[model samples]
Target: EREWPLAYVPLLIDEKEWAEISAGLVQRADLFEAILADIYGPNRLIEKGILPAGLIAASPEYLRPIAGIRPASGHFLHMVAFELGRGPDGRWW
Candidate 1:
């Protein structure tokens, strides 16, 4: 399949647009890291009356198979990606 035909067009983004996109991605990654820390640790978000316990209980992907398995060295989130695209209205999502 190495010689399979492919169709692609190069995207041209300005420096300002790239900066905005990068900022949004970094913010999302930071949020995910905080959430993972809460889920695997003391869960102060729930204890402090911030996040509802039922919300966690109802999540399908909540700690099920790997309930008590801690990370190798306290590193929870290893990798993450955001599939963003510019919308018709020139908004990145």
Candidate 2:
């Protein structure tokens, strides 16, 4: 596959997989929403020692210098792209 977002996925012959993929898409959206919310908020997981602080601090993907600068629309990501795959345990990854 192209690793493109679901919005860009073209029609295929796998109609039986439609419902499964749709459910996965919904779940992926929910995960993105939760991650965004946690990152910008109190961040209990990071504060409580559940997740490592280095996880965010060392990520070059997030520019920390831009914190608190809200855009006019007040949303960091007006558009988000998500791709889904499975873990070795047969669970969603």
Candidate 3:
């Protein structure tokens, strides 16, 4: 059998801090969606030299076979998880 580790104590945050964090996360998600849409669709980032074609092509996560396929939900990413860590300065990175 496998067991999952759980935290007994919850980390608390003030409303203002939570709002800032939430906004940053939303912005990150939006950026990810835009990047994914571009790479799989028009690829304007690569075409405009904002991103190198070779770099994206070499990535393991880049799926060349499904480049032009559209998702039923009309979004490439339905959900995403981010691994966050606090820096030495006590700021979340």
Q: Taking the candidates one at a time, how many backbone clashes does each contain?
A: 0, 0, 0
Give stretches of model 1 more than 4 Å off. Answer: 1-7, 64-70
Candidate order by TM-score, decreasing, is 3, 1, 2
What TM-score does model 2 achieve against the real structure? 0.55
Better structure of 2 and 3 per TM-score? 3
lDDT of each: 0.78, 0.64, 0.86
> Estimated TM-score per prediction?
0.68, 0.55, 0.78
RMSD of each: 5.7, 5.9, 4.3
Ranking by lDDT: 3, 1, 2
C-alpha positional error of residue 15 in candidate 2 after TM-score superposition, expressed in Å: 4.3
Predicted candidate 1 versus true structure: per-residue lDDT over 1-93, tens digit per residue? 544443377777899989988998889888988887787677888899899989888998687556456777765788997766666897987
Q: For residues 25-93, could you state the per-residue lDDT of candidate 2 as single tens digits?
A: 778777776565566655676888877879887887766756445546655555767655655785544
List candidate 2 stretches off by more than 4 Å: 1-16, 65-93
Q: For residue 76, what is the lDDT in candidate 2?
A: 55
Where is model 2 poorest over a 10-residue stretch in terms of lDDT?
Answer: 4-13
Better of 2 and 3 by lDDT: 3
